[model samples]
Target: MVSITSTASLANALRKTIVDTQNQMSKAQVEVSTGRVADLGLALGGGTAQDVSLGVRSADLSSITNSNAVIAARLSTTDTSLETIATTAQNFLETLVGAQSGAGSDAQAIQDNAVSGLKSLIGALDTSIGGVYLFGGVSTSTSPIADYFSDPPSASKDALDQAFVSAFGVTQSDDAVGSITQSQMQSYLEGGFSDLFSASGWTTSWSSASDRATSNRISLSQIADTSVSANDSAFRGIAAAYAMVADSGVTKLGSDAYNEVLRTATTTLSSAIGDLTRLRASVGVMQTNVSNANDSLTAQQNALASQIGALENVDPYEASTRLNNLTTQLETSYTLTGKIQQLTLTKYI
Candidate 1:
């Protein structure tokens, strides 16, 4: 009876040791594998807000990337519109040079061509993407150039001029067309307006003649010319060009006046083109810079994510090794505990 009782007690001791070791092994496996020691913070204790903060920061990084993508798209579209405007300006300049092809009435044909170019320019100004006007400043929903087809030209020329002045201040319009020749218009557009209008958030307050006189002067330092001014004289150039074009007696004027008018037209168009090209180029550069910035930000986001993952992701191989070691220790502990229990004096007696 004593022997049996001693053996039973030893077996119980061994069973208890094995159970404790197995539990310890299970916990070690969970820690080594999951990285996070906690399965459910509620059962163990509680969690920190750091995890939530990390998640929020990750979301913010993603939002910034998305915003940058949108800006890049807008810059591309602006470049396209600037190109169209430049092309139209070039065509009108060509017509002016032709004067009169013997195949058609020179004056009427020139006027018609000018009108067509003017319409296209207006269209370009009013162009929109996704309900937002490209040239409408901060008021993206509004058309930059109001349509004039409903009114007769005689009745609406002044109004049209006023509308233009309202859309782009006299200062901006004049600065854009300053002193450049018509033949140079294409180059100006390619180099000037192209740079300006393509900028991601480009905007100007020159929405009226009054504003032009007061505020529409953004410096042209980015375009090669720094000597340009915003004085009343700057605007007179366009007014003069319009007068020359409207005066039906260009053929009657002495060759000198006719030549002067032609020269002035070339100059005015060239300046406008220059401003446009610069605007487009600037926007293009901005887009590239922003894209690079976004890429860097994305890389940072990835790095951060990896760091976070390191704290949470499981390592199965490490977990398995630790679990096996714990199991072996538990089995040995059980065998030792059983042999020690069997050494009771009751069994020996």
Candidate 2:
């Protein structure tokens, strides 16, 4: 036995054992450090397929959650714009009520405030993000609201001028406008002036928004309305209230005609205030839905991640213990190999 187990042969055997122990130590160290199996395919076997599937689902859920964050931001901005429009309308409504007495000091103030309100409305409706117009509905590329009082005479201003002249056969600033009767002014307001803010009219001049808003898939089985348009009736009513008061010859009208304009505009504004409130509420609901969907999606993602971890992860303590054992074994093999190589028949004799 001693002859057969020669110095060279015994050393070779220890060398092989050392190499195997080193390989095992390397793998164990990796598993301990990573908290996951170093060879998932080999460790999990047929279960690797399920691990891959779970990983894909978890990744998809995470992607959707990220996407919903963007959607939530857009909705938050939309809600803010809607609130601004509603507040503008409410302030204008209060101003209109205060000026109903038609005081001299109040007249210019009313016109000035109407001008400011129209500007506010236009600015809010024209709100954009990332080159996409939020109020453009699905027509995100275009500005939704036109500048009604543009100096060069926007399409809306030009259209208003034509409608006013056609209805009364006189320009708004003409002295003849002062001679206009209340009934005549009322008819004009109800007819042509009203038409100027109608859906078709607004589309032709004041707005380029589509009737249908943009929608996005928020989850695998759900979608959300991601935008609102300037063409909605609430926006139309608000614009009309401002236009009739600001542009429809208020500065040139007789007392009766002027009061008639105020009465009509105040009524429209009051109703529009309610509508604008409801519009904000609707957007709020969308915000809530997005939040809930994201919360649910995140929870699902965490659950899927846990399942994936169970399949791929290893016990770090167990791996660490195995690593220590292999290290000791490797060291012992090196020592044994060195000692065995030094053994010689001549030295023993």
Candidate 3:
């Protein structure tokens, strides 16, 4: 039998055309709605690699900027705590000076204030945020400062007693402290006593913090220091000043010896205040650097977004126009298929 045109075959062909046109219309609708290619592989092909690279870079920058935000907040809190510690030292220094001036201020009151200041200083240095201790340098889990005033005789307090006895041949509470000259007291204050507050001594007895400070990656090419240590020189100075005045048996010493101790402690406190100010200034510098890094990251992200859009985004207006044309073609195909279905021998007759 020779091949001949049939109404059923014609209808089947029209049905296939209508289905293909409808699928195209669906893709065009998606492109218009999303302003992106419905099929990235089909649209970008070889350029897809470039789009992927840009996307990955954008994501990395986003992660860095978010981490920068957290570090910046931590540094800000550190700065506030430093301000508090500095002010506490300043107040204690003022009280010590007034007492040394013989301005009717008593030694016991000064001692009480030193005790309070030291406690406050330790508390401030141990400040924590989000369960992480701030003053422990890169070691962020444990508290940075030890309470030497607490029971069981802290290591620092024990060291102070032993050093005093070795230098003067007696404990600080001995009546022989009254016989000691100002020169002898000054020597002890500047010699073995001073070593107790030295950096190495601070780490050994007073602090568990690391000398290695914490840093954060603020940008691809830049990092910023984000933490300060309780074992820093300034903190050591503060601790020394407070310990000598608060626990060095000032009540039993002669007038000259007592004055010498006050003089040395006051000097140490003053120097610590200056150093603390500078340390806070350093954190301020880190804050500025971190802010600048975030700005740069944002700019890079914006640039990456532009490049990615060029590669992957579609023009909504063009997509809409194409979709309308496809809609008309689909309607025409449906109408032709319906007419073909109606074409039968009885209807034609």
* Model number with the top TM-score: 2
TM-score of 2: 0.88
Query: What's the lDDT for candidate 2?
Result: 0.86
Q: Ten consecutive residues with minimal summed lDDT in candidate 2?
A: 100-109
> Which candidate has the top score in lDDT?
3
Estimate every model's Cα lDDT from 0 to 1. Answer: 0.51, 0.86, 0.87
**Tens-digit lDDT track for model 3 on 42-154?**
88899888888888989999999999988988988998999899988998898888888888467778888888999999999999999889999988999888777778888
For model 1, residues 1-349, the per-residue Cα lDDT tens digits are 3535565676777787788878778777777756654353433333335555666777877776676666566667766766876787777666666653333336545555655665565566666778856555455565644443335443234433443344334422254324334334334333333222222211221121111211111111111111111112222222223333443233443444445545556576666666656666665766666666677777878987886565455567776787888888887876687577657666667
Report how far residue 220 has shifted in candidate 2, in Å: 2.7
In model 2, what lDDT does residue 276 have?
82
List where candidate 1 sits over 4 angstroms from the true fold. 1-47, 100-105, 152-156, 160-261, 315-349
The better-scoring model by TM-score among 1 and 3 is 3
Model 2 misplaced stretches (Cα beyond 4 Å) = 1-26, 102-105, 330-349
* TM of each candidate vs. truth: 0.53, 0.88, 0.86
Q: What is the C-alpha RMSD of each candidate to the true structure, in Å?
A: 12.4, 2.8, 3.1
